[model samples]
Target: MSTTVEKIKNIEDEMAKTQKNKATSFHLGQLKAKLAKLKRELLAGPTGSGGGSGGAGFDVARTGVASVGFIGFPSVGKSTLLNKLTGTHSEAADYEFTTLTTVPGVIMYKGAKIQMLDLPGIIEGAKDGKGRGKQVIAVARTCNLIFIVLDVNKPLAHKRIIEKELEGFGIRINKAPPNIVFKKKEKGGVNITNTVPLTHLDNDEIRAVMGEYRITSADIAFRCDATVDDLIDILEAPSRRYIPVVYVLNKIDSISIEELDILSRIPNAVPISSENNWNLDELLEVMWQKLNLVRVYTKPKGRLPDYEQPVVLRSSGCTVEDFCNQIHKSLVEDFKVAVVYGQSVKHQPQQVGLSHVLMDEDVITILKR
Candidate 1:
């Protein structure tokens, strides 16, 4: 796969060199994005391993490497948020439609990696092929989560306009609802009560609003399971082609305490100040929890070996002896016994036959002597 990708890149580079006049900056950018996406797919595993199939599918085995899609209306601080999250320093401007294309970056969170993609802003009538909304939605379908950024200053009706557009595209993302982030000046500290109106409501009203959105206190507990299966059920339906979603409330530094309080009432709505760089770590932690990833380590005991080295094997109740056979016919022929080291003391360093059932992350030392 690496060779194929390299060859494709070489071909593109050669074409760019030969057809200088034909290749535009936009074309080059598209090529670069394709190359990057391909590299990511290869690292994640075979394509369509997650849920969906074809170009719209995601890689499930690579759920530990989460990807969040930043989506919202024009000038909703999507680009700024991406820059803040990944430190990519992408171009950010105050004008509408500053980002004409989708940009991707990697953000490291607590030793885990998450990919953040800044998608093109959506406009009204996007579902019917208006503006760049359709293209943006296509890009978003490839992500594991979507952070719908909304300006709190806008009226409720205007906010609904964005939601309508998303719904028009037949994208059913209920897990991570659109986060209402109030973007304003950076002078005053984030005042939840003053800046966010939702904070002014009593706990009962807050719960009511969450209930209307299908978000309840139980959802928080449900999210704690920290497994891909849980995340999948939360974001996408039981269908074979659904991805997870996460809500992010960005630009909290601009809001008043009262308004911020109201915003805080929403479940799983993260507050972040892109300008001041506040709560980014907390946001990442929330995303990690939402991903529900399980870590498995493999120590080679020697050199790390190449990238293609297989540390884990997919099996069907095969024993250690069978695994040795799979690794090489000669290893099975010379297989004497297997030493296991894990679980209780009785099982520690125990020499067992090839029929031993391997538990998750069990350390097995095969003996040929």
Candidate 2:
């Protein structure tokens, strides 16, 4: 029996040979959908493995408001950088694959306890179960932020390989989910609406994805110029995660100043010498910015707002209702109204309800019924 990886390879080979045109669009869409399903199956693990975590023996207890996972080829100073950033000793050495498990650490920055994970090094074919790469990447998918560590001495093409590994596992780095809204109906026979002209996909391609998923009745609305893969992603949304990634260029001290200047131009990259602890502060700043956390301060009815400790919330989950729920589940039930004072509201502090969206650094006072 061919393994899931083998099956995926065969499909990829077929896709490479198939040319893309009007005649082949439907076939290409079918192939892409099949490839997505196969990859999900591969990530789901083999039969009877009893799926729990990504892989056995490395899933650690999660902590802090957000987690950052490190991924790189062997010996790219991931452990050294982790130790320097978090003061947690994760066996650092000059050899490859020195750290074999998920090493967890915590660093308090800007009143937020951020968890940092030092994952094992992955090779070229890591996505296909090479040297615990699948497990490492799996752990990384759950993290709020990912630091792709790279050795300055190595070829920059290594970055693309790591990206491909993550992409094959359905991890979209530094990307937002496609603006395609999907809904299922009991009797509708595949209705599609688009606000903007789709340059990359047509109704036939979208229908091909929906047909492959056996979704005979549904409504899909495309808001952006999305491709067939984007439509398939929405159909297989459970298997995908839109994650933020920061490229950490390690060991800058090994290269000359001219070489360093060239490496700095890479987008979303932070050049640092992990061994020498250079530019560590900037990395933390970039990390905090990418995390996009909202820190809401609670102000008592007649007292000043508490700035020392904050009720930190993810930007996506920082609504007034979410804030109340975070404080206490029953608080929302007993709430009369919430008075907000900050940039979220205009002019003055206004009375808002549970549905009000809270912004970062917003101050709020809840009045009970």
Candidate with top lDDT is: 2
Q: Which ten residues in a row have the lowest lDDT in candidate 2?
A: 48-57
Please report how far candidate 2 places residue 237 from its true position, in Å. Answer: 0.6
1-369 per-residue lDDT for model 2 (tens digits): 998889999999999999888888888888899889888887778663312366665799888889999989889999999999999999999888899899999999888888999999988887777778778888888899999999887748989999999988788988899998999999969888899999999777776777888889988888999998888888878878899999999999999999999999999999999899899999999998999998899999999999998888976557899999888989999999999988889857999989989888889999999
Q: For candidate 2, what is the total of clashing residue pairs? A: 0
| Candidate 1: regions farther than 4 A off | 1-64, 155-159, 175-241, 301-369
State which candidate has the highest TM-score.
Answer: 2
Cα deviation of 274, candidate 1, in Å: 0.5
Clashing pairs in 2: none
Query: How well does each candidate superpose onto the true structure, as a TM-score?
Result: 0.50, 0.94
> Against the unseen true structure, what C-alpha lDDT does each candidate score?
0.55, 0.88
Query: How many clashing residue pairs appear in each of the predictions shown?
Result: 23, 0
